[model samples]
Target: MIKKMSIVCLMMLFISCVKTKEEKNFFSNGDFYIDYYENEILIRRDAFYKKGNLKAIIEFKNDKLDNAKIYNGKKLVSQYFRKNDTLYDSETYYDNGIVIGEGNVDRWCREIGWWNYYDRNRRLFQKQHYVILNNSQLSNQVLFYKNGLLDTLRSDIADIVFYKDKGGASFKGKLIYNRKLNEKSYVSILFSDSIKDDFSNMDSVKFDTITFGDKAIMEFPVIFESNGRKNIRGIVVEQYAKEENVGDKPVNMLERYMYIDKKVDFH
Candidate 1:
């Protein structure tokens, strides 16, 4: 009799578990709160229309949204937001399921900014930026592209230098090619404007080219040599040639280098 009673109790427990497998809650308006289980553990919850259209879903990992939650409407449009244990910012789409816009919190500034735009298809486009400023007087800005690319950026600061003066005051200059790395161009500008009178006509010349390869190394032409220990000289590109390897073809290249001099005060 004792063994029989034990078996009957085990059977009752199994039935109880099965009953909980299909647990559901219904709202007064007829929306159903549905849940799914795996091995007697709740794994998913969803809300459904009276007509059986899925409206919203909350996925679970130990009863948390380990992945993401999705909200849907009667028109079959759906939007999803990533979640850890809480709902983060998310983007929403139109009835056609095309992304319309998205917004998120700026934890630093506690201010929220959102963007609304359009795509080539005339669909609504949107993005957002949140600013958190450490300094009250300074402002922050963020920029984004339609393709979700970061294009350019600028920020406000308390101090910035518009001009700098060392021993002498102002200088005027034009940029010219000074060197080449591979096929890339590198240029330097010669300052033609200064307050000193020591600069000569050689300083007026600018634009010197430097070639890089096995055939041509590098060369320069001197414009002016100072009389003192320090030389204030202008330089220009002359010519260059690279030696060929045993099995490789020979390569030859040439470049023009120029130099410009400006007045300089020694002391």
Candidate 2:
């Protein structure tokens, strides 16, 4: 008789947790309530707190998570827009109706295009740009401060296919804008295989400062045959609002390296 009663209680608990094909499921505890639909292609759930205050609400359409909103104590904090489970666009609030940050996501959910960020006071604090490079890889990202001040442009992986059977390791640059006239700049490239004595240009070299129109770029060739380790460390100094070569300061520098066990291949 005791074993039979225990089995019956377990059966009742299981039944309460799930809904039958012809029945709708609802559960509540004081200030919390939830509704579940089991027969839909994509089951949906709606939850609420005291006085029907929506804690979270997900509205699905045609078996897809179309849209959703999340709240904290009746204050909407986040809102998301999705199609087929892919988040396309979304916005987050600071509980005072201030948009914190908003941007677009690619199909793979990698952040793409323009992303806007705001300070707690709702002022435009920063903006970032992401570029999809070769083979759909996210390579370049440029960030700007308020009022279009160029902060930094970084390309973490600058891999490029040189030939059918040859490749090299590379990455994007740390570009800085030189606003002064005839701003001179040079870059130093450092290769990882450098030893204490007798190093060639492939090990390290400092190029002379050169000027360019609106911007100047320094490049060094690092060729490798056997796979080991490779790197290029560079620095760029420019005269900003100072006399020729006077008060010149390094505006930006970059150091990127990668390992190559085989030839570079894109296909």
**lDDT (C-alpha, whole model) for all candidates:** 0.43, 0.48
After superposition, candidate 2 runs with Cα above 4 Å error: 1-33, 36-44, 48-53, 83-85, 105-114, 129-142, 152-267
Top lDDT prediction, candidate number: 2
Given candidate 2, what's the lDDT at residue 229?
41
**What are the C-alpha RMSDs, in order, of all predicted structures?**
24.4, 14.7
Instruction: Write model 1 residue lDDT over 1-267, tens digit each, in one string.
Output: 454568889998887767346578889888897888877778778878777777777666775554334455555443444433333455556666666655542312122333344464654433333322222211122334545543433211111112223434432222222233333332322323231222224334453433322332222332323322322333333344444444676656454444332224332
- TM-score, cand. 1: 0.34
lDDT of 2 by residue, 73-102 (tens): 778887767733544586778878799878
Instruction: State the TM-score for model 2.
Output: 0.40
Candidate 1 deviant stretches above 4 angstroms: 1-20, 67-76, 81-83, 87-89, 103-127, 130-267
| Highest TM-score model number | 2
Could you tell me the lDDT of residue 237 within candidate 1?
38
